[model samples]
Target: MEDGTKFRNIADLDIADYLDKDQFARVLNNATSIELESGQTLFEQGMPARAFFLLLEGSVKLTRLSPDGNEKVIDLIHPGQTFAEAVIFNGGPGFPVNAVVLSPSHLVSIDAAAYLDVLYDSPKACLDIMARISQRLHWLVNEVDRLTLHNATYRLVSYLLDQTAGASDESCDVCLSAPKHVIASRLSIKPETLSRTLKRLSDSGLVEIQKDHVVLKEIGALKKLIQLETDHFPCTDKKNTLAVEIH
Candidate 1:
């Protein structure tokens, strides 16, 4: 268990991006921290959502389980990201997906009632959350567009290019943030299909796959192969394109 002071500090950190000293301190007083092991579930689909979580370390996979017992990965959460907030605010009976740790992880969990109280009392905090939700929706839209594109190679290469944001273009190495199976689920592609697409790209001298890492041999060739605008393929701002490359 974390000491009260440390718990409060983590709580303070969660809302620090949108709250001031007084408000952060108040929110901190009502928050707690929880640890999860790899493969442990934080929440399940159709379960009442009573709280929201801010991931402080490690990664969490958001997945939806179908009636036939199939699981489809929806997204991966990294540090500095909040999950289940929309469900909490929407007063929904259950979350739309299941959340499970991909690795040993630490999270700050805020009770829905407490968070809602703060949101009602703090207009700025509400605005901040609304803006964040809007941005996330925009990202989801782009992801849908990418998936709808008929070309599998385009989807695979576009996903790779997206991950290169903020990386040194000089280096060929690119780390994949998620396992191949999880990535395939998120992309709505089969693992075998993804593997074949990657192999084809490699054969064309476009990229190299080394274990969990990918090395872009010729980015220009990749952009052309994917039919994406060359100027927009790698993105001008590096950080925004980091996850796009390997997702």
Candidate 2:
């Protein structure tokens, strides 16, 4: 499907910002544009990785199927961002996750081989690409750390605190862009547990859930709560170790 057409939206995306005119044109010439409706899956986990994409509009979720037949949310991609980038370097394999459109989306899919070919002549472009991949890798590492080293409440609170830190206004509001279950999966907790955590925060005057977003009413309390949860988490692991001494 690569008939050498122009992808006009490339100029505004961060991926294109690193590419020079010739470099940009090369990718466009080797790319295919796609439009898909909500609930459409672009690719499945373990599917061959022949291409990557720049989302021109709408939201997308990258998820993986766990061994227990459950799905885990890996990331939520926004407009102007790229996804499936790591697959290009995955080396002789398939995509690590499934890419599903959350809303009607416009995307430009660039052939992996063509994109890699252009990088050889552009050191800066290569570095930019690696940075994006590395950032995702870092997030994955932190995700593992969060899942294993803390409780569900601790995870949810930390998630809210992070969202609040990234907010642009003083309201300290966090938006729930995905379904509650999806968000819960991302935090490694159940949907019911997420609701209960939110309810408890609301009851304690620490947060207000008006609709789709949460307002952090007392930022200081949340900070303290997160620390308390971390330090005083049920001592199951520590308790096992102390069993010999106590007995």
Tell me which residue pairs clash in candidate 2. Answer: none
User: Top model by TM-score, which number?
Assistant: 1
TM-score of 1: 0.80
lDDT of 1 at 229: 34
Candidate 2: segments with Cα more than 4 A from true spot: 1-10, 164-169, 219-224, 227-247
Overall lDDT per candidate, in order of appearance:
0.76, 0.78
Instruction: Report the C-alpha lDDT of model 1 over 1-247, residue by residue, as the tens digit.
Output: 3465434445445457887677665665677788899999999988998888888888899999888999999988877778888888777779999999988898988788876887889898899989988988999898888787444566777778877776544446777767888888888888887888788777666788899899998876665655643234655565333223433
Runs in model 1 lying further than 4 Å from the true structure:
1-15, 217-247
| lDDT per residue as tens, model 2, 1-247 | 4443344446777877779989988888888889999999999988899999988777889998878987889887877778887767858579988999888898888899999999988899989888877887898898788777777767887788876655542348777767788888878778888898788777777789978899988887777666755566344564222211110
Q: Provide TM-scores for the models.
A: 0.80, 0.78
Q: Best-fitting candidate, measured by lDDT?
A: 2
